[model samples]
Target: MNPFRHGLLAARTAAVMPHRQRQLATLSAEGNAPLSVLFYHRVADSHPNDWTIGCQRFRRQIDYCERYFELIDLAEMQLRMERGESRRPAVCLTFDDGYRDNSDFALPLLIQRRIPCTYFVCTANILNQTPFPHDEAAGQPLAVNSLEQIQAAADAGIEIGCHTKHHVDFSHVHDERTVRDEIIHAKSELENLIDRPVRYFAFPYGLPEHLTQVAVDAVIEAGFDGFCSGYGAYNLPGESPFHIRRFHGDPEMARFKNWLSFDSRKLRKNFSLDFRLPASRIPTLPVPTTMTPAFSVLG
Candidate 1:
């Protein structure tokens, strides 16, 4: 950790956390506490990059979540929101970009603790045993997770989410065919490998600029249970839970606490994306056996 950076974050969090805690308490009592969905990319100590966090720091964040918030899976969190019954401060953990190193420590710790974590993977990178393009550009071609690792994660009760076939940014792609291939075809391939319905999807880059209505429609049409974006916002009660908004899980303990502890500045600026999906569209758990496809085969 950079001492100067850490010191600043520590001082900021210390100064405001008590007030933030009080605000959170009031929100919780009013049954309107915002749900925090945090997304991480990699967890390791060697050759750390902007997206990587050390294993020790990762564990500490998990411990902090256990102490202060109700940790729930994406499914349960959506359920509570749909029912308008989210009364407790809660968090859902997710990892973006499948990394082999996470299998070494981070994933195992979550599994051991029975924590709900959704691991999103770019299928082509994992399938071809290639590094993500961003990593290659950074001169650190970190190893991608293997299919066996993904299957094992699913078997261990971790939700496997799709991050597209090649981590395609939806904002750049406009055609319907490409959208279907990335959203629908990718989900099909991943489910085949894991032998379970791959329910959630997280957008690559996950910011407002990285999204398009076309891609969002494709995701909805493809029958995904929910989709996520990482634009540093919170999901509140009475909103459509299908579009999950996530904050970046930075490595610094103070930064992580400051963001998750209902930081007043962030809370004031937080706004939900208008996916235009209604609460009625929120997919129900244990989908009925008699349910039929929403659409027939596409050309």
Candidate 2:
């Protein structure tokens, strides 16, 4: 196998093992850890050109989550965490990058269901009316909601979070000042426009090692209640509020089932075995790559 494949398996295994142990611990513990999941840039409808879930698949996923997990808003999740309350396998819904379809499509569905959600918007994109780099690269127009529309969503009971000013990767950027600017200044912009406190932050393109400790500290210093990352896991009590992990949803039902049943222990064991192999051999192996964005509706 190629080194890339082997490395990928090793990485996956490393993540899964610890997660599995944690899950086993949770099962044996007094209460289940409250799970707060985060999603990014969902597509409005399934189309041949889009990388997001189609409308039907999106509905089914939402239905599944709602049925299995007690759907709670971010504020409730935060309050419970702060109060040291036990959460009963509840889920908090979040969408990142202030996609316009969030307003056009997601908002209505959420409102119709009376489901509350938080949307993290990148202020620069909304201000400049520009598309994200990936979208631009893919020849797709910007699909973020406008300032006015966001305010309206807020009026309709949706919460807004900050997703940085320019969507720059904080993990890759070196300048401390720039990191602060991206996080702090972006919070200011959103707070001003929304006429409310912007307390939550989500890292743009959140990956492992994406945001530096310094950047996370800066976000806390900037007065955010907490922050989120794109890593797949549930938040346990006393977790660093600034680096919470989230899972991505697939358009396929079977994939979603695996994600829901995903035990950190099993993951860890699988990862341990994979990590022992040559990095080159990992990708070609029959390890489940469903979690990756290969079949992503928004890819």
- Quick one: best TM-score, which candidate? 1
Judge candidate 2 against the unseen true structure and give its global Cα lDDT, from 0 to 1.
Answer: 0.64
Per-residue alpha-carbon lDDT of model 1 for 158-236, expressed as tens digits? 8899999998977788788998899999999988888898889999999897768888887887788889999888887
Instruction: Give me the displacement of residue 45 in model 2, in angstroms.
Output: 1.9
Write down the TM-score of every candidate.
Answer: 0.91, 0.75
Q: Which stretches of candidate 1 lie over 4 Å from their true place?
A: 286-299
As a whole number from 0 to 100, the lDDT of residue 263 in candidate 2 is 49
How many steric overlaps are in each model, in order?
0, 24
- RMSD in Å for all candidates: 8.2, 11.8
Residue 93 of model 1, lDDT score: 94
Clashing pairs in 1: none
> What C-alpha lDDT, on a 0 to 100 scale, does residue 132 get in candidate 1?
89
Question: Model 2: per-residue lDDT, tens digit, 1-299?
Answer: 46677567556645554554455346425554455564746657733344466666677777766665566665555544444554355566788887776666667887777776778888988888888876777877657678888889888878789999888886679798999899888898889988998877888887656757767777777877677777666654443333455666655555454455444432332111111111111111222111111111110
